[model samples]
Target: MTTLLLAAKAAVAVLLLASGGAKLADLAGFAGTVRLFAPARSSGWVVAAVRHAAVMIAAAELMVGAVSLCWPALTWVNLAVLTLTCGFVIAAGLGYARHRGRPCHCFGALTKRGFGLSSLLRAAVVLAAAIASCMPVRPAPQLHFTLVFHLLLLAGAVLMAAAAAAAAKALLTQPDSAGTVA
Candidate 1:
């Protein structure tokens, strides 16, 4: 049970870290996405505000990941994960409904995917994982296998992040038939 819990914590941590890192890597791109989602008309103030918000959101995700990784036993970390995932799910759902054709810009420049059902589904899965990780279970001694497993999971997350970046760079650079960036 402890092993399972630890694995879940590690998985979420890796995901959060990757997401935060990606946003930080391409703050300008992320700000553009934020502008697309914003209801207000684009202006100097709006652009600056979106940029700041993007940084704050990325920082929060990184902090959550760090806390979860460093103190897996802390229930608050799991709770924070769950809360953040839920918020993301709601935001994504709304974005999908309101902005049908705009790029999601979810993982920064890691993908040009649009916000849609898939976004909600992904968030749902992450929310479930966070919930399961938060559930009470009989505590057991941490084992070497757990450490190895989490390390592998983290590596997988990194690979996924790299793949996303490559895909976005390749796909997003191309223009649509209308000569607009897709």
Candidate 2:
């Protein structure tokens, strides 16, 4: 069970890192998704606000995920992840209901999945993983990571984020089936 919990935690952390990095790679695309949820406001400030919000959301995910992965002992980080997962679930449901076939850009150009049942299902799975990660592991002392280990973990997290960003950027620049940039 402890091993399962640890795996769950790592899975969600990696997901967050990848999603955040991908979003950062295509902020304009992610901003469009954010604009969808906005209160139908059409103003310069509103556009700027949505862009800022998208950037902040991506940054928060990256920071929280990196911290959680590098220091699993911080139990509060589990709850933080759970909270973020809850938001994702809500967004997924809302996006599915309101924007059926619209591309969510949830993973930037790395994925072409639109707002639909698949999106909802994926969000649910992520939520489940996050919940499982919050479960208490027995004899926590059995895993005592040193400062060096934590630093190494952090480095790996950064690398994962950078790779995801690079992949998304490449996908964004590539021509689509219609001979248009994605």
Candidate 3:
């Protein structure tokens, strides 16, 4: 049971971190997509607000991932994961309903498809994993650091770094309307 919980926790942490890192990589592109769904995009202030909100959401996901990895035993961490998963589910549902064919920008550039049933299903599965991690269990006397666990963490870190680099490169090379990098 402990092993299962640890695996789930690790998986969720990796997912959150990867998603957050991807968003942080190309915040402008992410913000542009966000603006599409926003209720108001008429004013410059509103656009700025949307962009800021996008950054906040990404940062929140990253924080949650870090906390979950560092302290998986805490019930609050599990609850936070569950909450974030639920939010994702809801957001995917709403996006599917309204912006059915638009790119979700979920994994940054990795995922290009628009929100759909698949997106909802993915979120639901994550939510289930989060719930499973929340189930009551006797706390272990000490946290076990297995080879698999270490490998998982390492892989996640590498993926996040790669994604962030790609995003940064894209951001840096993006040309403004004046045909020059901003």
- TM-score leader: 2
Question: Could you give the candidate ranking by lDDT, starting with the highest?
Answer: 2, 3, 1
Q: If scored against the real structure, what TM-score would every candidate get?
A: 0.74, 0.94, 0.78
**RMSD (CA, Å), each prediction:** 4.6, 3.1, 6.3
**Model 3 residue 150 lDDT score:** 52
Of candidates 2 and 1, the better by TM-score: 2
Ranking by TM-score: 2, 3, 1
The residue-by-residue lDDT of candidate 2 on 24-118, one tens digit each, is 99999899999999988588999999999999999989998998899998989999999999999999999999977787888888987778899
Q: How many backbone clashes does candidate 3 have?
A: 0
Instruction: Give the local distance difference test score of model 2.
Output: 0.90
- Where model 3 places Cα greater than 4 Å from the true spot, the runs are 142-182
List runs of model 2 lying over 4 Å from the truth: 175-182
Each candidate's lDDT (Cα)? 0.71, 0.90, 0.74
Task: Kindly indicate the candidate among 1 and 2 with the higher lDDT.
Answer: 2
Best model per lDDT: 2
For model 3, how does the per-residue alpha-carbon lDDT over 1-182 read when each residue is reduced to its tens digit?
Answer: 77787788778888888788877787776787678777753878889898998898778888787667755656788888889899889888888888776667776655565778999889888988888878765556445456687567556666765676476546545443222244
Model 1, span 27-87: residue lDDT tens: 7777776777676666688778899998888778877876676556567778888888887
